[model samples]
Target chain A: MVFQSWSYVGFLLITILVVRLTSASWRWLPLLLASLFFYSLTHWGAFVILLFSIFYTYFTAIRVSGSAHMSIRYRWLLLSIIGQVLILGVFKYLGFFNGVMQGVYALLHKGDWNDWPLLVLPLGISFFTFQSMGYVFDVYYKIRKPEMHLGKYALFVSFFPQIQSGPIGRSKEMMPQWTSISLPSFEQYRWAIQLFVWGLLKKFVVADRLGNYVDEAYDTVGSMGTWVWLFILVLYTVQLYADFSAYSDMAIASARMLGIHIPENFAFPYKANNITDFWRRWHLSLSGWLRDYIYTPLLFSKKKWKKWAVVYAIGITFVICGIWHGASMTFVWFGVVQAMILICEMFTKDRRLVWAEQWGRTYQWASVVLTFWVISFCFILFRADDMYQVAGVLADMGQWNSSLLTTYLAEKNISRLMGILFLLTMFLWGDERWDRWIKQPQMSMNKSVLAISLMLTVLMVLGVFGKNDFIYFQF
Target chain B: MSNEELTARVYGVFRKVFKNEGISVHRETTAKDIAGWDSITHLDIISGMEEEFDVEITGFEVMNMSNVGDLYDLLTQKLAE
Candidate 1:
């Protein structure tokens, strides 16, 4: 069930009630059943594949942890990674690979070959595989102990709140909480509700509204002027952040209600001064996973290369990051561009710090603005469906006309647009402060009530209650 | 070298790698406690320590070293060897 729906709300309430009523030791049983039931709602195929992943990784990790010989452990780790990657590759990339083969066949003048049937991508397969693989890595590295309990390990992978989209939880943080499941205190409930309401406002009011404009612009890409395309690019970047971060907030809130803390995914990424900083803040769980599991090992293995080792690692890691999002060349290019930017930032770190000190706050502000624009432009590649669309959008940037901007502005809902702009400004201004306030151990009841009530009122009055599934759901 | 002397030498490597003169690390100090000691600078610190102490640190050793104390322990073991 989608997190925003009334059915999900009811499901969550029932699940929480069940958990609250269950004895401490038996709590995980009901929670695991609920999570599986929740996931089964998507597709039985997805359900079966998820089970395969859980079982495979569970056994592999145990094998890795059980082995005494370092070579045996290393071999098991490779086997586990291959299993996860093969699952991801066949399900996610088969179509893209098939299409590539078709192109090659056409080039060779080969007559129509039989097409292979594509399997439905299990929802959150990308997330869970990475998470499970990370668990295996942790076991191999001895960063944390291997979880021997099959039921608890499955719950860690399929926990309903974060199963679809995640802050991508770690076992060390989540496993203990599951074993010690307890009902959230009243303050915790209040905080979860507040976070949920804020996420709703971000999704329905801000993201969906901006999405309307972005979708419209993409729908008529050929006719849009350069200025309009640029505006739409910026809007898409904001919409993505709002949409994805909204899902993360809701997920974290849902998990928090069960007293399971997931990682924070986004940290005001737009305020970042460079691409490297942006990655650190945006999708923090995934980036942290990559840094710790992928980039660090790769760099250290080639540490003899010194600085070039970092460059090599960054390039490979981000290319994988791009492919991790989907099976498209545009996604690959998106990763390549980010890797390029980060490499530049790495090489210029000392110089940039010197510049920051020389120019102080002005340099910081300018860097933030510049980074936002760079991210916005790069997101054009991300937002487009394929390379052709990316080319069209980039080509459109060459045709500049001011009158088209006025026409574009005139055609849209000006009042709604103004409202979105105002809300966006207020959100940017108060986001960190609001986050800090809600996270405090003790908040004044009166202030909490007032804040939540105001947010609910805004959401009800302004939210576009259309069937806009979260953008990241596609990934 | 004594543990104190080794820790002092490691702290010196951290300071030089991060370019911060006032930096000090203790047993409990971690990457979170330092501003620039991320995955990237982490390698720099490792390399600097290797140079300063004339020892080789394996990737496994680096991964296991979660804090300054861990590093100090690894260094002492390496130096003794």
Candidate 2:
């Protein structure tokens, strides 16, 4: 189930209550059952898809582990990754791919557009597929041992909090936690509540409000002026972050509440100085999963041809990543632009090092900011509906007449922009830096704790706009 | 090759890959210690070391490789056995 859904949360609360009363060993079962119910609720017919992944990977690992025949074991691993990816393609990309193929065929005058029809995308298909593939790839590399138990493996893939737009957990980070039964500790509950409230604020107070502008602007990009275009670009930056990260924070918080600790998926990504650094922080789980499986394996393509390998690695990984975002050309372009930047960063590393050393930290920060703006501008392509709209937005960005500012920046727009700026700055800034209280207990205060708790209560009451799914879910 | 020569060759490979001057051969040096030692250069260094030392690296070896010393040990074992 999507982490924000009340049904999933309700089931989770009941499971936590049961675990609090019962032994820890049995806690895993209730959550596992809840997770199954959660998945079934969304796409009961496709529950078999997750089951197929689990059984395919589990048995493959069991059969392949420490096997004498290396090629045979590797073939199993390849077959598993390929199989899961094919399933992911069917569920996630069938419609978009078919549409695109039809368009391409129409352009070529080889076939009629009516030949291909769109298909319904199964819920959580992208995330669970990636998680399962990562698990199987980890086993193939022999970095992690296969989980012998089928139920546990299923739980690992279908864990409710991360079943939707994910902090996609790897076998190494999550499976052990999956096997453990959590106790309902007060500390965990406190943090969970705090995180959940903050996420609620992000989604309702920030993302939804910003969406009011971005939604309209994107829906009709042709009439939009430069100010409107710029505003939407900035708004999209915030909307996407808040929408996805709020979901992430809620997932982490929900999992924490159940005494299951999930990883932090966002890390003040706006503060990132470079595209590479931005990537390092943004959608951290997926990037990391890509790194571990796609990028690292591509590194092993060959030794003597390693330069080509690096180029190929970055190129292919991002292609996979791009397509993973959706069955769309925009997402593909986004991935391509990111890959190009990464490659340039690699190629110019020596010069950059020399420059950084001579320029100092502030200059480095400025450079990173410039890089972020360039990346942000590229995201305009992503925000646009099609090539025509993309061209229109680009023209708007370039056509800066100071005279148009007064007409476009109405008082309402100004207030919205200011509010967005404030929220985004707060979101981008590092949370609660322990700047020199390193020796001391940094977060010390029982009195302030009450104040914090009260703030959370207020935030939750004020913040939830209610029932918005994560933006990435559509992809 | 002796462990010392292997270490020297690997160090040379890293120096060449990273394009950093005055890099000294040491078993303790890590990727973190060198400027421009990102994943891209990492592959270059590993590939160069593999070619120079004429030993294949398992993905496991690449995963666990931390410091230059680990490379030395892996190289030694691969060459000797």
Candidate 3:
């Protein structure tokens, strides 16, 4: 269940009560069971896939790390990675590959190819498998010890809050927490509740409302004017950020309430002035994981490539990242665009810095706006159904008119849309103020209560409490 | 090599690679301690250390090194080996 649902609310409350009532030593049992229960709510078969992966990685890691023979350890490591990738491939990318093969056969004038029903992609398969692969690598490299306890490792793999959409936990970061359970502190409870409520506000009031316009605009059959496409594009970008970051905040806050600290996923990515900096601030855990596991190793693999190694590594890593998003050509092109821009940024760093120094704050703000628009342009590919839709949207760029304005104004919920925009502005302003003020002193209880009550009121009235499937869940 | 020699060589490497002469690394000095000391420059530093010391640094060693002190200790140990 999504964090916004009443079912999740009930589950979380019960979980908190159970954990608080239990002894510290036995706390993990309930938590683990609860996690499995939550995960299996999607499909019992998905639970089985998760279990097999957990056991496979746990055993493989222990063997890889504990092996006496160097060659044998290397073999185990390779096998584990291959197995995990194969599993992800079978479940997620089989349809894409099948379609490619069929197209190839048609082009070659071969006989008609038989179509097979694609396998159902288990929820969180991509996330958990990637996480497990990272763990096996960590163990093989001796960066972290393989967990001896199977149960703890299982918990690390299937932690319910982060299972659906993740800040993708590393074994080194999360294994120790699962090794032992601790009662939630009062401070933890208070912080988690506040963050959870804030996440709900972002998701329901801001993201979902923006998503309504985005979905409507994107689902239109024909092309739109340039202004309409760009407006809807910006709305999708904002909606995605709000939705994904909202999921992260709730996941982290939920984990925090259980005395586990998951990593923060976003850090004001729109503020980034360049593609390189944008990746650093967006989905930080996945970026860091890829840097450590994929990019760095590729960069360091060959001495002859020298300076060009980083360029090659970045291209490869981002390509993999795009494919990891989905089995779609649009996603592939999205990764290619990002990598190309980053490589350009790398090459022009000296000139860019010189320009920055010459132009000062105006240049910096200009760069930020430019980066946002460029990213929003790329996000059209991300939001499209296929390449045809992408072309349709791009082909209609010339028809600039006031129809978009007239049409949006004609919608019945125009006032609600305006209200959302106002709330968004207030949220952004208040967040900046709070960031600066939070370090000075804690808020008084009365002020805190009044602020939270106001937030709750807004949540009750303005919140779009509709179907709350998080956007990232599709990946 | 003596620790003094190693430190001087490392200091030179940092200065040349990062192009910042003001950087000074000690036991507690980490990536956070020095401006422009990111993963890209981190690779340069690793290459520099390996070339200057005439010693290979393994991936394991690279991953485990937390600060200048750890690097120093690792270099000393690798050199002894």
Q: Which candidate number maximizes DockQ?
A: 1
Chain B TM-score, candidates in order: 0.92, 0.87, 0.90
What's model 2's lDDT at A192?
Answer: 64
Highest TM-score scorer: 1
The TM-score, computed over Cα atoms with residue i paired to residue i, of candidate 3 is 0.95
Comparing 1 with 2 on TM-score, the higher-scoring candidate is: 1
- The sequence of per-residue lDDT tens digits that candidate 2 reaches over residues A231-332 is 677778878887888788788888877778788787767767778888888899999888877787677755456577788888999888887887777778
Residue A403 CA error for candidate 3 (Å)?
Answer: 4.8
Report each candidate's C-alpha RMSD, comma-separated, in the order given.
Answer: 1.6, 3.5, 2.2
Global lDDT for candidate 2?
A: 0.73
lDDT of 2 at A254: 81
DockQ of 2: 0.43
Q: What stretches of model 2 exceed 4 Å from their correct place?
A: A5-8, A115-118, A182-184, A411-413, A429-467, B1-36, B58-73
Rank the candidate models, highest TM-score first: 1, 3, 2
Tell me the docking grade of candidate 1.
Answer: medium
> Where does candidate 3 stray beyond 4 Å?
A221-223, A402-441
Better of 2 and 3 by DockQ: 3
